[model samples]
Target: MVAFPDPNHAVRIAANELRIAWRTLRGKSTAQLASVGIVVVFGAAFTAAAAYGAYLGGRGLAENPGELSQLVSLVPAGLATITLFMAAYLTVVQLGDIDVRDGYLTTVPARDVVGGLLLSGYVRAAGLFTAPLLVASAAFAVGAGSPLAFPLAALAVLALTATAFLVGFPIGVGIAYLASRSAIVARFKTLIGAAAFLAYFGLIVSGTFDEAIDPILGVAQASPVSWYADLAVLAVVPSASAAKAGVVLAGSVVLGAGGVLASVRLSERRWYTESVEASERETDSVSSGRLDRLVGRRPAWVARKSWLRARRAPIKLVFVAYPAFLLVTPVQASVEAGHVTSSLPPSIALYGAWMTGAAFTLNPLGDEGAVLPVTAISGISGRDFVGGLVVASAVFGVPLTVAVAGGLAVLSPLPPVALACTVVAAAVLPVLAAALAAGVGTTYPKYDATSISRSREVVVPSMWAFGVYTLAFLLTAGIATAVQVPAAAGALANLLGVADAAVHVGALAVGVLLAGILATVSVRIAVRAFDDYTA
Candidate 1:
């Protein structure tokens, strides 16, 4: 009988594997190196800026010793919040990408496998924040004007940053593991990611409304950054700054210890076979084919396929949500700010057009993936395939445009001319979007599964498509504006009213005709590219 490996032996084996994994990651391609280098440069720049700021802060605090107490009181709270946000975002991205491709560490010992994953999480989180923190400490030291204080300040900042990472790591790993294994959790990931985005967006938006929320903000006066700022202030004042720094250092040690313990416990719990089984079961249920019916017969085939693809592919679903959210929120915000006419309430229709266009242009040929060879072999003309896709886009795209425009008209202060222009512009968007997709799809069809996320493979068409779509939207918007200006300026003037009506009608006709021409061109280009490649 074969004896099972001891837990100690398993851990040793895992550690070895982790060392190898680290080395393997170090041996990346030139492209990967460039990408990492860019990140590091950005990181270093941010750190240098923070360091300068800390120096300035320290100087100001030295001058006004009383401000030291206030700054000291705020740093912990601020640090805690920032740590949470960073950890959550990092966790989501790491977890989302982990199992995207097949053949991930199936042969490794279970203990080592888990250990490697946890270590990777740590590395990712640490890498993201390390530079900024080092810079901040360097800044604090320079500002303090004491070479002796520089090393001490650096040590203090490192301790705090490490503690934050420790706290965030296990939580992130546990959440990511849970999300990857369970379907319910996976669906919720999108919601979680969306919430995170909204929170970030809200932070920026809130600043715009800060005057109204001064009282609430006052309650948060003891934020963590403030405490750190105060610590710097105190360092130059009386010996009281030294005492306060001592307290902060001690707290950092305690927090760091607690975080490590928490992470270990979570990792152990996650490693259990029962937990993995339960997660797998949940995921299986989540990946069910409930929406397959939507992809019905000929005309409906493209729409159905697009819908199904969006549903089954989590990344696609997540991408689609961006346009959806933008249309509903920021677009609405723009309208409210008078950047957009109220007659174009950022609606589902607008999102559909935008998403459909993007999906087509970027992923058109790439989405076909391995099936492209089979498609070519089967003798299906590229023109026919392109036609089907265009048809599919229109099925979903047109109605969404109308609905958004109509909704905007009802809710906001839109003139009839403005409403007409909005509708005309909406109608033009998807066709341009589709045309762009076709052009890109024909030129840079990505075959590799790994190429999905980078999306740089479809660069040429993607750029051209974007330019075309931008121009088309601007032209449509201009036409609409011209029509609206006259109508708005002279609501009772018969000549202006007639001209506005004529322009609106003319714009719509022009848009549709242009769409037809572009669609034909896109189909022709796709067909020719398909033939050349296929032959």
Candidate 2:
């Protein structure tokens, strides 16, 4: 029953796939097209700048073959690591173009499908960088005063890219094969992916990524991967050996061919195998619990629904994690020194409160999706619906903010009195922030769904809502922070021509009172808007 792969058919399939991608690009929205244009322009500009820089460096180093040789050797190692890692990463994430998976797999041989998909991916990647890379190679060749260097360097880079992608793609496919068959991987794939990403992110933020890079580079340089350098600079660099160039060129072809064969086999296995199914299931219906009785059943149910959805599709709330990057510099500084700084506490409080509102409270109307009409006319008051969102955000945000901010404040040089105030503000600000966001979200809602994944789509909150809510949070949180920092408070006092004590006590009291007033007004507005919603 096994069918032989037709290379001609695979070529046609890849061409068709590329045509479809081009059509899709042409049909994108104006904003999407503009973003793509911006990226291409930036890429082209960066490429030109890099090529010019390389030309200058190459010309200078032409008289210093020893230095140039060492630099050239190191470049290929780093480049190999990057190319291999990126190719594997792209393959792992995409799992092949999903649109081609169905009809193509059923109609064509698995080998042909895999071949076409790989070709398509290669073409797409090459389309972006091939011209720029060739330009850079030519510049380097001219600067080095070797006419033969241009073709050699281009060959090395192109061969290296092709070989690395071929090798990496199979590794990714192998990983996919394991994931499809493994029950444990199926159950906790998301958590595993998140942990890997977080670990990688932590390394970069801590400026310790070199700890990871050093070993990879050392191993790569010691291996045949370093042979590419010989091919690249064979004519210009005295250290470049003809024998090594021959070995690398020959090895790359063998490896690339073997990788293609392995990929076809692996893809066939993976495509034919039934994927492991997750057994965990949620309850069929939402019911109000004892806590729900105290908080009103309708709002409680709504809150419960929101929590379930968040758990099921955590990507929808990925925006909440964006603020974590803001803490990197301050946290890194604190790590270098001994203790947290005064700045860290306020940053935590402000950004933490911002994260709270952004998590679940924003986009009240849009988040409801197809159920908007049903939910709007379900006889539940706007008070219940809006209250549910506020509760959902505050319950999680308040405790977390208090724990993080209070913990950091305890480690800082802040006085006991100020620490207490900080903790109190941390706990209270998130609640007010949630209410503020709910109000702004309802006033300026967005209902258009944006795709987050192949199968999942979500309606993100409007930029107007984000802008207005950020401004409101900054005002409220800024005043609270200023009151706590003596220098800031003194500045505020001098600006307003008030005494230090009045600035510390009176201003904070007034800020809290104003924040409370605003939160109340915003909540009422949100409730009214939700109640009157026709869509």
lDDT of 1 by residue, 159-192 (tens): 6567666667667767756765776665565576
Q: What are the lDDT figures for the candidates, one per model?
A: 0.54, 0.78
Task: Give lDDT tens digits, candidate 2, residues 1-535.
Answer: 4343578877888898788778867975565688789999998897898689668756765777763355567777877777677767767666354474778878877888877877876776544565677788899888888788889989998888888878888887888889889999887887987798789778866778899889999898888888898888887778778899999999999998888888888878888889888676665544447647768888888888788778777778876776588778867777677678766786787788888988887898888889989999999899999889888898899999999999998889776666777787788888888888888888888788655543456777777787888888778766776576666766887999987666656655666776777788889989999888875
**Candidate 1 lowest-lDDT run of ten:** 452-461
- Lowest summed lDDT window (length 10), candidate 2: 282-291
* TM-score of each model, paired residue for residue: 0.72, 0.90
* Winning candidate number (TM-score): 2
Prediction-by-prediction clash tally: 20, 0
**Candidate 1: regions farther than 4 A off:** 1-45, 69-76, 95-123, 177-183, 186-234, 239-244, 274-303, 317-352, 450-498, 531-535
Cα deviation of 366 in candidate 2 (Å)? 1.3
